[model samples]
Target chain A: MKLDLQTELCRRLNITYPVIQAGMAGGPTTAEMVAGVSNAGGLGKLGAAYMVPDAIRDTVRAIRRLTDRPFGVNLFTVDMTDDLSRVREVQRMLDPLREELGIAHGKEDLRTPNWFAEQFQVLLEEEVPVISTAFGVLPDDAMREAKAAGRTVMTMVTTVEEAKLAEEKGADVLVAQGSDAGGHRGTFDITKHPYGANIGTFSLVPQIVDNVRVPVVAAGGVMDGRGLVAALALGAQGVQLGTRFLTSAESGAHPAYKKALLESTEEDTVITKAFSGRPARGIRNAFIDHVENSGVAPLPFPSQNTATGDIRKEAAAQNDPRYLSLWAGQATRLLTDGDRAEEIVKEIIAQAQELLK
Target chain B: MKLDLQTELCRRLNITYPVIQAGMAGGPTTAEMVAGVSNAGGLGKLGAAYMVPDAIRDTVRAIRRLTDRPFGVNLFTVDMTDDLSRVREVQRMLDPLREELGIAHGKEDLRTPNWFAEQFQVLLEEEVPVISTAFGVLPDDAMREAKAAGRTVMTMVTTVEEAKLAEEKGADVLVAQGSDAGGHRGTFDITKHPYGANIGTFSLVPQIVDNVRVPVVAAGGVMDGRGLVAALALGAQGVQLGTRFLTSAESGAHPAYKKALLESTEEDTVITKAFSGRPARGIRNAFIDHVENSGVAPLPFPSQNTATGDIRKEAAAQNDPRYLSLWAGQATRLLTDGDRAEEIVKEIIAQAQELLK
Candidate 1:
């Protein structure tokens, strides 16, 4: 028997299934991946946080070229400004890593772009079907414009307070991202939670459900049909998969990074701010070890991310995973090699239907 | 109207329901709470890790007097011995908390008892129907003795390797504890995980379930029927709750501790080793702040636990929540003020039945 697993959020997003391929930043999320998920009935998304406006527009156009199904674009809404008085100290912290990776950097060079505003403008101009923002929600005018353009807005929140905040900001859907999630945690404020928000999905999904009226999609550690059904049982309307798509056929992840995810265990991942100033869960390697063992804290988001970009790029070019930031969740063991997004989505739905039966 | 949710493990436990009141150490679990859960068709347990042998026997008798249903007694399987070479430094580190709590400590006076042997003997002598061990499993001889005496042996494991180890060591049931659980995490060996076992429930349960052959009981962050149903959907045969029972009518927790839990948010609690020299999840207090800010690594398990014993007792005696170890899970906000174990169990089962229907 086919289960009626489509939730109200599915209707709102105009998707046949209540599964979301999370808008993971940088590599991993590709136009092909997003289009494939959308074609397979689940919502596909482009992780466009670090992308330039031009790239965002290109990806949106490319996804449109592949599928007419509804898809989404994710952006980072947090400001990039920071007090760089301690920039030299943080740069010094990454000196050893840079030397080992053969990246030339003598000055305090980092990218602090006015990208968020430009990115928001591009998202609106692209007339995207779904706009998902991480870290925080879009501003009022931009948000109103997106709503005015008849686009669905999704916000990632780690706590009930953030959920309430996102709902108050007129978000159409709340993605309750758990600590088990791969990549950067979407904690709204870092001053209050310097340790990073570590709420598990099992506790987080229901609490967010009880506190907010907006439909929720459970993110983090959701790789299979069991997670899908479990999220449904916890009252989440859908499951947002991040690492699940990392090894998919359409993922743009580095070969070494994808191999690391495929070989890792549940306990192999750690949440650290070594790569980015903000806390993110990823496979532990030499880079994380050096920063953590030395007791030198990374500069706040974008700063640390900027400082480490060259080394990560060099490491990827050399296919050395030890120096690369292999962003992955705790459920890496549940992942397989090179399954297409259609197979991934269909397997989850089929497994869920079997379990529901 | 009812769900036939009973699994093979439930039958082996001689219970009609699949809920197991976690054998929480120290205070939360009581005879009445155990009896209430057992009477209501779930397994209840006594947290007798800190109690003497006579106390364990007395509590078993007390629980038996209250209900004829099956009950369990819990004991610590981990050794109390640690390299006390740094015990003095740890004692020195805790001087401020001791002074503030009005504890009179002159020298290295800490309790190191041979309790495991005595406790296990008492459980076997009293013929406990179910025996649950934490930290590690019982010794081979004790396992043989417990099995020969017809007792169901359950072991708490935080990782997949530990789950397989526990099963190999004759664990009839495995309590797959997530990092979201309150109190001390039951990592088999802390040498590998100096940061404590932190696999989230959503990721931990299914991974452990897929690896082990024995019946698995999902532990940590399970507060209500939603959690129960979710655990079931995740492939766990049963659910074990710790903090869910802390605010129960029959709970032996201090009034101030209960009040602190009632007033706390999910983010308010943190996992710190300041209290017990072992990583435990609890509502953050001033004592934790002092230890954390001072950057003092706690002495190993029993040493740190012993060093801070007087301060915790005095804090409890004085009804000060600030100085006490307010052990709780991440689902603190979901808890009510005062509900009996029976109500807690019935409501969870009822809600689960509704969801299943």
Candidate 2:
């Protein structure tokens, strides 16, 4: 019953199993969750894109203390130069929701500088073992620095072209993010692929693996051992799980967000640009419906992301699931209640071992 | 080096291999193509949805002459009702394309009665071994007639709810169609899901398998041995392919249409309701671009389907692919040139056997 699921992924990433906890940005991936996954024989990752340098350093140190096992910090190699053309209009649009959530209206400044440099610096200073990115591939110099520091560099891509480009740009691994992935899509060109390339995991993974010399990790809609085995069968060296860990006991997701994820079905999620000018999959709620039905195009990327921040945070604070993003993949029906990250990893490995033969 | 790849699907469908050539409607599924696939030890199905009862009877006789192996005929259990509200506007919109194709501007009738009753009657008279339906499940009486005649009934579904409904309605087998599938999506409720349920094969197949008692056949974006093996890994008893066979030598697809399939990439195809009011996946064409950019809702389902019929047929006659539907899945890069159906089937089995161990 013990199926050896190890592949080039293990040797390359120094992990025991081929499972990688997705760097889910926001708050879903906490230090305890990452450490739990790493200690359970999978690669644990900090969703550090939103965290400041000090917070990221503290979280990495926290994870290190919990376990010396290999862990990663995920950042967004994003273009911070946001287009402000629609910011005032979108901000005005979100004010009503902010008021309803008992948050300030028109009180926050929309323009803010990104901290990617400081965040990258903290990772280098902390000597993080693995660094991954979303939104775009790490720059050439960043790739070189990470490789020099003995850290593996991975980036998520939604299309085969993006995968090849990232590989050419010196990425160590490619994560093929299928349309079924929760949260934001990893498509590189927001202009060319406004809705991201909608390739499914079954179709996207093998094509990406075939084109790139670097190992490919399958992501999106994957929830269990069956998914891991299927990803391997599609020629991926490993599988990256996003929504699966969002409901784990060790996850940092709010109670309402976790409850919504546990109750929703596969049909509930849709790729909407209302929450973040870039499209992300989440359970449809009053906030998304109102924004979409208003027929106003949301401000591009970080602008729209910034516009909705106050309302989302307040919704979480008030335990109102309807106003929260409630990001989850299509496999939400498969989610169970209160399992820790370690237990989930072991269950996946054991189930995958049972299904392999 | 040979591998034993047969599953319960082989026994249930009474075939040597679990590959089911998709019953692509329109002109692709020729009698010769079906015979070639059946002769190669897989099930071949006739795309009889657009064909008349006589044509269906003739195709079955022709397939019987070429190979005594089991073959099936696919029919549409569709609602023939028309919503003509937008027909005139859409017809006017398509007139320019029709004129360019050297066809009359308004020569087609938008209202047409469906031949489901006659089609079902012909299948029973012809004693077809296998019968399948798309768009919707077979009517309860039709299911009874098919089962009573010792024929197996198959239906395609795009969501878990539809799969369970079809099983409860008495479909002997269910083909779980993923969003990556070309041609029309197999979503049962067009009202609730205007865009069709967009779950990927990797997620849809396993979920349907777990929820339904009947065997599930994974469809969409599946192209070769690796797709076949991957579908099996996800617990599907078999796999169905549509776009893969469109380029096969024995297929009845127009030469220009076949050429487009060979040249297009994954990003080239998108789901659009332009060709039909109901959403279907096809390569992006100038016709689709004009319709979508115009901001006019396509006349619902068969009305839009009918209004565009003349333009489509004339484009085919003129050997112009730009105006044709050009249905293709995301795995267009996997397509090759002019292999006969039998050769393709054998190649897939041989390649899959090599990968199984």
Candidate 3:
């Protein structure tokens, strides 16, 4: 018997499978990966948070060029202002590491550009089917525009309060991002200290489901079929995976970073704000340890993120994962090496379908 | 059609239902509650960690008097030493609250009595069918002794490393406790900072199941049938609940604490080290807020816990929950009021069984 694996989210998103490839920022998720997952019957998402407006359009076009299957775009609603003084202090702290990595360190350009509006504009112009916002809530006008364009809007929330707020703000779906999730936390308030509302996926999902009428998507630390079935049992309409796809052939992660993830255990990952001012779960390396133990607090958001970009780039070029931000979930040990995104999607859905049956 | 709800843990624990009511300390879990659950064909655990050896033996006998079904005893393997100076500081910090509650303030006794050996002795003498250890790993000799006595030994672990260690140490079962769990964390090292391996139930259970050969019991924020099914779907053999049972008729929790739980939301809970020197998840109140924002660090575990004992007592006596610990999981909002432990067990089993079918 072919079990009815289609969830309400599947019907609403016009996808065959109730699975989503997470829109992981800082590489990993690429147009090819997004298209691969979508083509494999799951909803794929383009991690276009770091891209300029033109790049976002290009990526959307690129994904469309590959697959006509519906795909989504993810953006970070980050505050683009930078505190130069704090950035300079962070740079001074990074001076030693920069020299070691053979990177030039001078007056770091700390200005953060306002890219969210432009990115959203690009998303609208491209007639994207889905728009996922993280790090902050999407503005009311933008959300209205997306809906007007016949796009489904989803927002990532770390707490039940955020879920309720997202629902109130007319989010078509809620991505309950657990603390064990890879990459930057999708907390709406960047100014407030994170980890205050670090509810895990199991606890976060059901509560969000209960609070919101919209379909809930469970994220963070989900790796395989068991996790997918568990999320559905917990009342989530679907499961969004990031780390599981980080090793996919279609992922844009550095080879060294993927290698590190393959070699890592749950203990190898730590929630650190040293790489970015915001807390994110990543593989623990010398870079993370040095910054953590350095006693200097990182400047908020974009400033700290921008300051570390060069170091991360250099480390990637050198194939040294030690200095790279190897963003991964606690389920890194469950991830297999060199899997194709399409195969991963098919396997996960097939396995979960078997289990559900 | 009747769904087969039998799991490996159900068979191993000799229970008809794969559910374990949490052994919450400082009230809530009681001998009657434990007996009630056990009588309903699920395993129940007496929270005897705070009790003396005689009290533990008495409680075990008391449960036996109510139900002939097998039950378990829970103990904390805590380090029984305190820094008097730090205790004094904590006591001084609590002075204002004590004064507000019209309680006497004086030199607080900071001595932490060694209770594990006595408690374990009681368990062995009583020939308790199951023994659950938290806070620290069960000593090798005690574990061996338990097995010799034909007592199934289980240890609570918050991380995969700890789960592996527990298996290596011959723990018959592994209780994968997540960060959202109520009361004190079950971390092995009291000296080590808490929340270091703060994996959530959804993320923690599957990984622990993958690492351990023993039956894994998922705990932390699991409240009802959906949570139970979710646990099983995630590869857990059973589910353990804390807050859900806190409102049971058989629970020993103060009426005010129960009321607070009934009125609480997921946002109302916060993980704070104020009540106990160790990190614990509890309902947020004026006391928690005051202590958290007070800038004075709490004394180590038992000492800090002991220092706040009087205040908690007074708060309960006054029917004021604001000053009480009000320990609860993040899923407190999902809890319903005035249910019997047996009914809770039966209802959860029935609901999950229906869902599975």
Q: Rank the candidates by DockQ, best first.
A: 1, 3, 2
Please rank every candidate by lDDT, starting with the best: 1, 2, 3
For candidate 3, write residues A2-70 as lDDT tens digits.
123688899999999988998887777889999999999999998888888898898899999999999
lDDT of each: 0.88, 0.87, 0.84
Each prediction's DockQ?
Answer: 0.56, 0.50, 0.51
Fnat of the models, one by one? 0.66, 0.48, 0.59
**Tens digits of per-residue lDDT for model 3, B279-325:** 88888899998898888998777778778888999999999988999
Candidate 1 lDDT at A119 equals 87
List, residue by residue over A275-306, the lDDT tens digit for candidate 2: 87888899999989989988788978787787
The CAPRI class of candidate 2 is medium
Task: Estimate candidate 3's alpha-carbon lDDT, on a 0 to 1 scale.
Answer: 0.84
Q: Which run of 10 residues does model 2 chain A get worst, by summed lDDT? A: A104-113
Candidate 1 or 2, higher lDDT?
A: 1
How well is each residue in B1-357 modelled by candidate 2, as lDDT tens digits? 112368887898889999999998898999999999999999999999888888888988999999988888888888878888666777777777877777787643567668889989999999988899898899989999898889999999988899999999999899999888888978888888888899988888888998999989999888888888778877788899989999999989999999999988888888899997889999999999988987778888777887888788888888999899998988888887899999999998987777775
